[model samples]
Target: MTDRTATAPDIVTGAGTDDACCLFQRALGERFKDLPRSVRDLHTVKGESGWQGRARVTRGKSRIGALICRLVGFPEEAEDIPVSVTIERRGDMELWRRDFGGKMFASVLCLRNGEERGHITERFGAMAFDIDLQLADDRLQFPVARGRILGVSLPRALLPVSEAGEFEMDGRFHFDVQVSLPGIGMLVRYQGHLNPVRSDD
Candidate 1:
């Protein structure tokens, strides 16, 4: 597997202003001081501490939604899954990485006007797919993106409905996300709170 992040130098460049870059880096620095050492030491997500939480995944209600989830290798049902996530600076772009159980996932996020756009790559068994994603405020919005399976583009109609968001509550981060399809509501949804952890813990 290739590290797409390492190959894209231009992807991290082109911030609109030095002020924005400074603010982003400063924010990450404060955030990094709050993470577990193991996660903070990763090459891409380095120098930052983040949150740990538990999330639940509910099965979709509609048959189409269930089918889409299965096609993408999501579990039929899951709950209280432990999660650890971090966001750090890699060159000029932000590197966000999440560890769900032992599965590793990552995205390279570009921030503009308090919003973000990025490429997400997820691995399911032996298959890995690239997804386009955007985030504004606390809401994750997808504007007609495609998934690749075995180097082939999957059908748009079958794409799981994607909904996600994150925010702070009680000084901790919280997030909720759902994937569904037309007529088949909520293939999977996960939500939980994230608390800061120390490197020694």
Candidate 2:
């Protein structure tokens, strides 16, 4: 699906800019171009950006899973859930703050260091996850390569399973993310569409 032209000068459309490519572009390398413009436009932004959307959220039923979800600020089950996101550049990292029906949660994203170079690291409090990305057809996937808490690595069996990605449909940006744990059946799964909300909005 083709993306609408951005009237704002700060909006990023594609490559060949005097400034370096954004985080996703740098990590995906040559495969970045394969993504649909709907996905590319959101990831290519260089500065602070805002997005507004709606989602369907499903929270885990397990007692322990519910507790964990609450602790992590995961939103309650709902359809057509109001969603808003803000992405801001902080040094070499990008801070993503999301509000799902006013249940706010945020994380820090940055390229991993050392042997895990090229991969992305998403940190939530003291827990950090190393994500290995894959591109399939017109979709971008994120799989946990490694997970650590308080600087200690977690066993693979203990790590949460994630089925997450961003895709394009009918010229709009869409996303699906389902996270589950070893004992917990499901933590929270949310799928939705996002459209850029310019500063003037």
Candidate 3:
């Protein structure tokens, strides 16, 4: 069989008014923006097995906390993984709100050529947490829940890249991530894509 995997290109650079609405909608989808209830959808990889399931969100109700997202996928590799994400909105400040949280789940959906790999899920919190950014001498700095931090540095040529394309928007948003699990030791050098959903419906 021929390998049909699509390779992403290096980040591109450009200048365009960074629109929050565009970014949010691109990350979480328009359906999630207006709904205050549970939501679900299918997730697929370009040349790999796809996942189909639903996500339930209990808004500020129940003992779980404020916001909770529960998603279930398919295939033996991802069948047992249930991503549990919690979202909390900070103060009612003007524009940006402080957001921070962790993801607790597991799956082999990120595998490349049968090797189990760590993949970033679309429902991950960091994917949709928006904030105001500043360009320093040559670096980009943004604030998180803990404090001001250094944001991902993309080449000047890859600024306008969206989640739709293979290079810019793949299964995983950040290619460089350091995750340390109890028994799993550490997961490094991870990357993948969350293929774009067709249609606005």
Per-residue lDDT of model 2, residues 1-201, tens digit only? 001111123122333332576777777788888888988888876888888899999988899998888777778899888898888765456778788888788777767872233589887776789999888877889989899988999998899898999999999999999999987788999999999997677
Q: Number of clashing pairs, model 2?
A: 0
What's model 1's TM-score? 0.53
Which digits, one per residue and each the tens of the lDDT, describe model 1 over residues 73-114? 454355678877776654445555666665555555443323
Off by over 4 Å in 2: 1-19, 114-118
- What is the C-alpha lDDT profile of model 3 across 11-78, one tens digit per residue? 12223413332222233343323322111222211121222222221121222221122221111112
lDDT winner among the candidates? 2
User: Residue 35, candidate 1: how far off, in angstroms?
Assistant: 20
Per-model C-alpha RMSD? 7.9, 7.7, 18.9
In angstroms, give how far residue 55 of model 3 lies from its true place: 8.3
Q: Rank order by lDDT, top first?
A: 2, 1, 3
TM-score of each: 0.53, 0.87, 0.20
Instruction: Give me the runs in candidate 1 sitting further than 4 Å from their true place.
Output: 1-47, 61-76, 112-161
Candidate 3, after superposition: displacement of residue 148 in Å? Answer: 12
Best by TM-score: 2
Return the clash pairs for model 2, or none: none
